[model samples]
Target: MDLVQLDIKGISYSQTQTGAYALLLSEIGGSRQLPIVIGAFEAQSIAIALEKDIKPPRPLTHDLFKTFSDSFDITIQKVIIHKLVDGIFYASLICKKGKNEKTIDARTSDAIALALRFKAPIFTYKNILDKAGIQLKTSTSSSQTQSPKSKVETEIKSSFDLKSLSLKDLNKLLEDAVQNEEYEKATQIRDEISKRS
Candidate 1:
């Protein structure tokens, strides 16, 4: 199968899954986009890698991997999203050192985070994109949409104040947040509940 080159178009908070994010991979010179749902920490890692100015005080895991690879004179040549099983993506890192190459299996999210840090190009099989890519409507595609890294914040906001809720209500809300997998909200609720305790 021919490999279709991809670029990280954006990353947005998942509308369907709480505490999950949608990482948009756009086919070069094509309309279809591959949306991979990733976790919050992974999303943040990718976002930080994308924005050149925002450096974390500490090296993230991906950064450490990059540094480790650099110390060994290894370079990531590229990343391939090789398989999709049960809605999960599997990727492999194509690494090279002194003419020796290795293919390392990795989760799609982790692969992407490392790819960005390595400045490695990303690709997926044409068949994979054909099987899973979603086409967008005219008005809200690609450039028309806000950056997913930024969109991650706006979609998670709510109006309810945790301070006003009673212990019982707070616990109930915490339960709902966990059930919904809104972990960010759950953390906030958990903190408030902790304070009261």
Candidate 2:
């Protein structure tokens, strides 16, 4: 089966799943998007990799892996979402060291995060894409109407009585959220700090 290249479209907080995030990957030349639900840590790691401006005070696990791989002269050539079973996606890292190439199994979310850090392309089989891809509606009329209400709800949830916390307390909460891999909470705390400044 032929492989189709995918690009990271965006990541959004999953409204249906508490503490889960949705990672959207779009076909390079197509409108279909595959949405995979990921954990908060993976979401944060991927987001940090994608956003050049945001840097963690300490290296994340994915960053450490990149550092270690670089030290050993290993390069990630690409990542492939190879399988989907029972609603879970499986991925592999195609790594090169000197003249040797090896494929290593990885979770789909971790593979995508590492792929971004490595500047490697992401691919998936055509069959999988056909099975899971969603065609985006061309019309934006309905979405525009619904967006404001959702945005308001999101703001209310993220605000979370941030006014009562000191700057120092907010910073502490941010650190704790990051350490605990509560990325959504960390984002809220970070936003609160940014607003204060």
Top lDDT hit: 2
Query: What's the true lDDT of residue 128 in model 1?
Result: 83
User: What tens digits encode model 1's per-residue C-alpha lDDT throughout 71-174?
Assistant: 99999999999997656689999999998999999999999999999999999999888766654434444565434432223333454477877787766665
lDDT of 2 at 28: 98
How much does candidate 1 score in TM-score? 0.70
Worst 10 residues of 2 by lDDT: 146-155
lDDT of 1 at 76: 94
Give per-candidate clash totals.
Answer: 1, 0
Per-model CA lDDT versus the true structure? 0.78, 0.80
| TM-score of every model versus the real structure | 0.70, 0.71
